[model samples]
Target: MIIEIIGIFFLLLLSAFFSSSETAITRISDVKIYQWGESKNRKYIKAKELMNSRERVIGILLLGNNIVNILASALATSILIGLFGDKGIIYATLIMTTLIFIFSEVLPKTYAIRESEKLILYASPFIKIFIFILSPINFLVQNLVSSILNITNKETKNNDWKQNLRGAILLANNKGDVRKPDRIMLESILDLHEVKVSEIMTHRKNIEGINISENIDLIIDLALKSRFTRLPLWKDNADNIIGTLHVKDLLRARNTNTNLLINDIMQKPQFISENTSLSEQLNNFKKDTVQMAFVIDEYGDLQGLISLEDILEEIVGEIFDEFDKQIAGPEILSDKSVVVDGAMTIRDLNRSMDWKLPDEEASTIAGLVIDIAQKLPSINETIKIDKFHFTVLERQRTRITKINIKLIVID
Candidate 1:
């Protein structure tokens, strides 16, 4: 009877250890584990090994925990039945239930929630040993489970790798292991497949292009003077882009040979729809081994141009070359108002200003204004939307050229 009492109490401690190990193992993030692994620490290496065999580790711990708990319950029942006859059975059941629930389950898990890193590192080796000891049993159990699942013709896979990685990156960012720019770049990579080329491609009006009818000398000079490496070539109209004239190719054609024909040196233009995604365009660029592509509408009219660099810039931010000139930025006035080019994208403004101006319905600042106003705004016309105070400063025919924004503060 004395041995039984002692045995049940010891078994409860073992139950508590298993419960804490389970909680701590699950709570510790992969980011923390990798960070630890960087130190070449044996404990974390073992931790990584345990993480790899988590299914087996969990199975072994659960099996061991249940075995101890059941043994404890039996000893407790035997002791109480000997001490107080039939009613002791009822008392033993109640006492053990309360004791196990509080001391073994709730207390250990709550402590683990706070000390997960330390507890997991400490228990990792023991868990690994237990996993090794129970591998054969775990395999049999896994096969049994699979056989049962096979009856329903079901299959399961861990497709949340992206989600898990995203979470880990975010967690690292929160822990100050990752900087803001790097975090943004990391998240942007996962988002590339979802973003459309039309969202970031240079608009047709902004493209540097020349008519193929121009003199070869003039074309060569424009190619030299222009900042862009690849210039779109038009045959009759600006919208009818025929080919992309590479400045390098043009220079080579001039230096290597006397006859400098633009048509002969120009690369065939690759046309893609405005609705094409950045991921699809990137794959196309890789497959075709092309640097630039011309974006077109449903009617085949040239909408804009997108380059491989543009898609890359979507992840890493703007890429500027030697010839690239600094574009005019927002002019911040004394009254806390900013005047900016209406052609500026809402995404760029939001990023630069750290404002939450919605970019859902429109792409550009001017477009946003037009969307909210439901009309082409006249110069000096002011409108209020949410916390934004929009005042059109400049208008060029049909489009708003420049606008002023004053964010209203709420007390």
Candidate 2:
């Protein structure tokens, strides 16, 4: 009878350890639960239920205390030889404690920590039973906790969804689920609204398009020799741009000789303001069935050209295709100042140079210089605005008028 009682005590202690181990392991966040109520997202629900019904859960835990109590009492009644059995009882107690420590406390908890998801799944039914069995205790606990909370003036705080979402993003980032460029691109896409069209458009001076009245042969000659597949066709100068013509359109034209006029092959160009957002313009492009748009100033002067590819480059960095012939990014000159390609987007320049160029109407460094100078900036000409100065470096029909920009130091 004595040996049997000591063994029962050991079993009860083991059960308690197993139960606690399972609960602790399952609560760790690294084990993701797919439902809305699982993980950090459902922390509030778990917190609320626990806080509100504290007494019930505590009572249930206390009920489990029978394991410890029955085990201790069994040792007292058995191995304990009535009055003089204190030493025997102590021996029995130590044996039971050691067994519980190894089997119930250490092993189960270790398994739980390592296999939390599996443990949680297995424990779910048991947890539900406990919740039901302890419902009355839960109600009492809830009222008591509410009353105490009222006294303390504590209100429940919900789960941090943004924090959780960030955690998920971080996890993906850590596991190589997304590459650095791809992540940056995703973020850049999200920041599209913060970007204006001027940052990504080709500057006006560098724009090469044939006039609508120009001979069809010249247009065809330029189109054929030219690297670009699409060319803006204007009525006069760029300011009067009528539409755009695709190389394919030229190929498909009924009359393909020098006598062919631009109006004969031109398709309408999408017109958008310099301040339009990239994401919005992308949608506009899709809706309008056009790949490119003419960016215009408030006065309707042609500022530059913006393409779907250009906007996409903002997010994904450089994209080189068969039609991509223009050099982009900045080239720091022999001097401290830089010589950026005219085709480089203002957004890229601003990010690279940390320049505070006004974002209102222009998209290229050249356009910004032109806007500020109000005329083509000449070599050795120094223009100062606030802390910055601009000196013209080089200029051409297709080249960026290289400029040396210096920031003045304030004493």
Among the numbered candidates, top TM-score falls to 1
The true-structure Cα RMSD of candidate 2 reads 9.8
> Measured by TM-score, how close is model 1 to the native structure?
0.72
Residue-level lDDT of model 2, residues 179-204, one tens digit each, is: 65565565566668778787777878
- Per-model TM values vs. the true structure: 0.72, 0.53
**Candidate 2 overall Cα lDDT vs. reference?**
0.67
Candidate 1, residue 409: lDDT? 88
**Angstrom error at residue 101, model 2:** 14
Go through the candidates in order and give the clash count of each: 0, 10
TM-score of 2: 0.53
**Runs off by more than 4 Å, candidate 1:** 28-158, 321-340, 353-357, 379-394, 404-411
Which pairs of residues clash in candidate 1, taking residues 3 or more apart in a chain or in different chains? none
lDDT of each: 0.85, 0.67
